[model samples]
Target: MGPLNVSLCMIVRDEEAFLERCLASAAGIVSEIIIVDTGSVDGSREIAKRFGAEVLEFPWSGDFAAARNAGLQRASGQWILVMDADERLLAVNEAAWASLLRQDTAGYYVKLISYVGDRTGGDYVTDYACRLFRNDARIRFEGMIHEEVVTSIRRLPEPEGIIRPSPITIAHDGYLEPVLARKNKKRRNMDIIREALRRTPDDPVLHYALGSEFFQNGHYAAAAAAFQATLPHISPREGYASDLMLKTAYALRETGERAQARRLVEKAVAHYPDFTDLLELQAILLMDDEQYASSLLPLASALRIGADVQRQYLYNSASGSGTYQTRYLTGLAYERMYRWEDAHEQYEAAIADRADYMPVWHRWPVIALLLGRTADMQRLMYAQAARLPRSAWSLTANVWMNGQQTDALREMAERCEALRAEATVLRAVALAQDGADGQAIDLLLPAASRGNSGDALLYVWALYMKTGASREAAACLKREAGGNPALRAMAGLISGEGAEVREEAYRLCQQTLMQLAAWDCLDALHAQLPAQLPYPWLPLHAMYGYLHAPFASKRELLAQCTRRFAALGYAEQLAAGLLALECGGFAEAAAWFAAAGRQAPDRTAPRIGTVHAHAAMAQEAARGYGLPALSSDYRFLSICDR
Candidate 1:
């Protein structure tokens, strides 16, 4: 145990991209490196030699196991540790390494984590492989692809207790989306499997391999057929049994055969009742069919498996995911079933596991609102907002402003104004939105003087969008906007002019209007719009109002907007106009006005959208507010007037 005698054995081809890191991680751990190069045209051979490896050349025979076996033959250590070039050995203490190799074992089932998305980190699959084994002539790898030495080691006498689990871990990113697209390894693997299948047509493992290759490349129908073909021949005792079962179910599900998938995984879990992956799959199948209550049984079973058990068996673990992800999914199921308190508990559990995960808490404010916990919505926003970096202040404030979370947004903006100009612009925007133009202008005038504070740029935009600032005030904004076409679009919006819309300018204008949270601004932008820009990001629902709002669905949203506007005390005309623009058609509104026979809008029938008809009412309604003098596009100038 003074120094562990370990040989790092690997077969690599054109792996120059990943070789250096792989060798470096194993540098101090392995005594020697045995690399079998399979016709590499790149610097794989040169890089291997730099690491002092005894490189052996093997002509491309399209057989992974044969190439690997050749490398294993050159290993001259008491213990052989096999790895792939795209994998890295996780760092471990020297004492731990020595203790692992000193164990009384023929081989060790090492933990293998294979990432499936971005290599920086995302979802992954994990499993155990007998990667470290005693160098024996009888113990060699087999199979054309998905090769392993476990079957060979099992042939030895009393093999059951000899191959025990170990703490050794290796991370592999070869299967990540970018690597898979670049390497096209799936194509080569499928070709080898098909050739081997011709030689042994009845081999279940080969059938499983073919199915796996098909699954990886997204050929679900073919994968499903191949997986079905392997079922009768597959043994429950095989290392791939659980994965095969899960992949088969996933393939069937992808091919629009969820019923078949449910039946298949439901049957498989009977054998692996304690397997977390299979149990989760069973629950997922139930959830997909909207049998959410019933799905809880399997989810509860999956949760009961304990963390150690969860770690021990991650077979096809992409479905198993992680505890937090599973709990998040469970929360969705409860939410769909209208079990709010139960769903809240599940979400709390999910967030406990991943408190700072943005995706998990992305809509938590809305969730609190849905639960009728207004105070909780404020609290959660404050908590998440407090943790944001300085760079995120404006964007986050813009998001809150656009969403019309008035109290929270104004509070955060006011708090941030003292810290930075970018945040100060947000405060100015908040004031302008609330009709406090003089106070907002005072804040923006000095902010705009400080050269290049992006905060000042938006402060100017607020002046143009909300405050009806004089020419002198707009000059500071013009200087701040520079030559950006998107910033220039606001001039046309406020001046009653039209221009062909550029995508950037158009998006900026749309976002600015939404951020203002003013119905008149939103309505004027669309009403005087030069033409519809086909940008996908354009909010058509916000643009055409109830024109996009399905006629049947406007009642609730109208009620909501109405009550919110009513609470402000000075937004009666604004509320009615917004209702017409957002939930009722302009032509229908005009007809309601015509039906009122020139009477004041409020004197008209209250039902059948008479209030909405106020959106296009006559001069009596337009007078005294100076609506016509401000801008031709300014439709509801009296929105804030008492």
Candidate 2:
């Protein structure tokens, strides 16, 4: 029935750019405004005054808590709402604030969304902070850098001290790239943190704060060290301990210490088995190692436990470890296992939960194609075209997939002509795919004329070769190759110049040759490649096997690639075994698959591969007795079609 009497408090310095916007956002709701200026050369003070704020001057003390406390002292309202000049309070109905004031709590945790790059959509981090609190002498801010009043609130009487979630939301853009670049905020914070640490050397909170700052600044090694140092001092009851462990593991992983990262995660999971964030991290680590089956249990645990544990005050576990994410990851694992039906089901569930998740949309068509669900694939393409109407790839794919002929494609291309090179390339590829080499060439000529012989130019050359225009193809290749030794060698070979292929050239040309389906050229390139392929070439070998092998010869080629990968210690044994089985190497494939199954019994790939291999061997043996065909063999054949 009456005003809530909220005081909006802020500490600012050179925040003229955002001060007015921040004040305007809260002007209607706040009863009084307290602005503690730490020294602003700009019009920040005038901006605050314009908003009828009670402006007080405070000398720069290099302590955020001290400045914040100064603002807190001047506040004269029943409720105090803390905010920065770079933050704006979201519009909430007055009834929500009235309801919040009715609660018997000392403080409330307001949701804070900090944008890093793009402000639109969900490209930001979610945090919860005690920004709303009773304006009492007992509650005051503390800490030098990452200051807080929550610790003081916790010292109040039990029932009166409860801090609960409020409807209040704040959007902070101080951490965005452009804003961060404008000021040396990290350096200033680091200085304050170091000074504070020097004063209180045993403070786990300072260590944690320092680690978080380092992580934000991309100092992974320093962040890892700081986070690791806090472990011994951190209490299990501390809400941030789980987050610290997660950050430390992530930092370690970034520094190429994945084993150490995994060990840390394992240790953390052992301690806090119910923490869904920890389980999700474990699942992700296992998935990264290609231990898909092993990943499923942790994923299942993560999903079963759900995101109930709010262990961290700053990080939102729901961003990546939510139900939709878990289902999506499970689907990916199923896909790797070649369990198309199971993968599709999980993917569909994920899409149902969050249709706007772009990765799910992208993978839907691929899964549909693999499962021979042409109608489903067409539906997905059309959906993508509608959702992303401006996307050239989506438009082209939709046109190509639907009953739209070259005329429709041309119309689409015309619509996208103003978009430049990317659109042109998409249209050309569509034309090329439709066997209109001349039309594709004509579409590519403008790009070629501008001396832009990138991938599109190479694609145009491939089209010329397809059309039997040898001289034109040679000329295009020569122009596009330029000074690049790899492309030059490729051009030389194509032009019948008898150029010797350099190892680098062969590596470079592999992609283009694959794209062109120039099997003979790939064969020549392969001969020039090193006998002992580097670790990075393992995927290239796999790609070569996929492109080169026909249905009848696929297993043998895949087995050869698998053996090479195995020799390099880079192949997932289950993947290799599947290839071996496809190639009819029953004994070796069966042995490897069994070993894999023994290692990860929960994994579906080895189990399915083993069943199909056994069935294939049985079917082969039964051929002598003229027995009926096996359904397992047919199922395996369907999987191998792609």
Candidate 3:
């Protein structure tokens, strides 16, 4: 009946550049601003004070929840919108916020949109985060870095804390800054994660946090090892298993272990086949491994499950080398089989999803030309021309896209002549794509001569494939390795050159051991190393089989992987349920998931499969099937939107 008074609460440290922007985003909506400055020397307190934000000085207690709780205690508003200094509320969702606060909702969930790296929007848009809630007394916080409040919400009784959905997003741009700053931040997070790991050696979240923290710091191998450590601690039927499995697979893939990554991802899907993240990651990894055909399963799974509209756009853009990447891949698949219109529809659908994605615009013209749709080719070419950037690549695209009869070819040749060695290699590929193998060779040779060892190796390999010179390509790869440490390592791993392969493997093994030791787990380090010497590293499957097989071979290890994989799915559900329990005042749901691992043997090995509902049940079983309640007679019904 009355306007709801909302508080803006945040815990910040050294956030000067974007703190003002964050506060400004929510300025007009909040009744008060509570800022807890944890040892910020970066003008953060002064900036908050300028906006009439109540600045509370708190020494860094190495605990985020404590600072946040302190901020909450000082707030007077009836509802709280929690935001970090590096995060900003989107202007587009202002109306939704106003409506949400005015309603009788106990707490609201706000979506988080992250900008991966580039401001121009390429190669990113990774995840969403929940950032809104009621200023209810029941909600409390926990943990340090990546702290959450939902854990405390489970202690509430009755229907006073029901979760209401809020259609708003907070834009996170922390990753867009300089790489060094990002690295430094990750280093700090690593300390916190390591501490958490020490405190709870068997905690899956802590292991995952440590792994992810390592990955964020670009220590890919360390990340894989850390993620692997979490696998043994999971209670198979618990909900967080999927997330741990997915992240582990992601780390492996990023470390050039695509086969292992793909296999692990497949394992995740086997457990929860419809999990959108699993499906997407599987497709992405398959494409990177150049397994175009294998990529289709997860790609189609993603489509069949109907992902978010934004994600659907990304899935359709995946066609760099595979049909699973975009609809054009589907069309191209059909075209390969001479199913013309089917291919056309797939291409058309891909373009419709987002013409901005490179694959659709590039292929439509080429595909049209092949199908004798000259008119369609011309139309598509003009559309592409309008959208293409005014770069050297676009010039080629314009020529190729326009059903290039004569002038385009001449211009392309001239451009090829003008480009540098690296650019020339690219042009040669373009020329090859245009069916001018001889000219492509001409462009490729000179380019290869002037290129770096890496580029030269690629050129030689391409030439070998183009000219049917397998021996030459192999020899070139060997020669390139003599001059490049990175290449030498990659080549040894792939070619089975015993001495070099052993050397590289030893390094990886040593690094892995060091990571495990640093994180305080020696047995885990031993388990990761293969029993036999000179392990196969040709395809990723061999590598994955080596890392996971030893563990998967033992039933106890297998069960643990299953439980851990399941636990991740449970964690997400728990996050939502915890939020609901806090807002909805339903204590049972909280107690149901919070209690620890006593999952039943009959519950399918979590690695085999599970749905969200199944994951919830598995999590409950992991909690010993005795969900805590506010009162003896209270039976908490989980608020699930089926």
TM-score per model over all chains: 0.71, 0.76, 0.55
Better of 2 and 3 by lDDT: 2
Give the lDDT of residue 96 in candidate 3: 59
> Which window of 10 residues has the lowest lDDT sum in candidate 2?
633-642
lDDT tens digits, residues 311-370, model 2?
443445545465678888888877665666787877776765555555665565445544
Candidate 2, residue 451: CA error in Å?
A: 6.8
What is the RMSD, in Å, between candidate 2 and the native fold over all Cα?
6.1
RMSD of each: 10.9, 6.1, 22.0
The sequence of per-residue lDDT tens digits that candidate 3 reaches over residues 1-642 is: 222487889988878888999988888777889999888878998899988999988888777778998988888887888998878877745655567767865565555555554562443443423356667677878777678765555456656555554566677776654633743776777777777777768767777778777776678899899888888777545435666787788888878888889778777777776566667677677656545466666667666655344322211111222222445455544443334556666776665554555555544544444445545644553455444333433433332423333334344435443233235444554454455656765655655566652254454544554455657756765665677675565444434453343545344433322211111122232334333434321111111111212222223332222334334343223332332233332343334234311242222111112222334455556775664432211111111110
Candidate 1, superposed: residue stretches over 4 Å from native: 93-96, 160-162, 306-311, 319-322, 355-359, 369-399, 406-429, 437-463, 468-511, 523-642
Query: What is each predicted model's overall lDDT from 0 to 1?
Result: 0.66, 0.69, 0.54
In model 1, residue pairs whose N, Cα or C atoms come closer than 3 Å (at least 3 residues apart or on different chains), thus clashing, are 422-455, 546-582
Stretches off by above 4 angstroms in model 3 are 1-4, 92-95, 102-106, 126-128, 158-161, 177-183, 217-220, 232-241, 252-267, 283-297, 307-351, 358-378, 381-395, 398-642
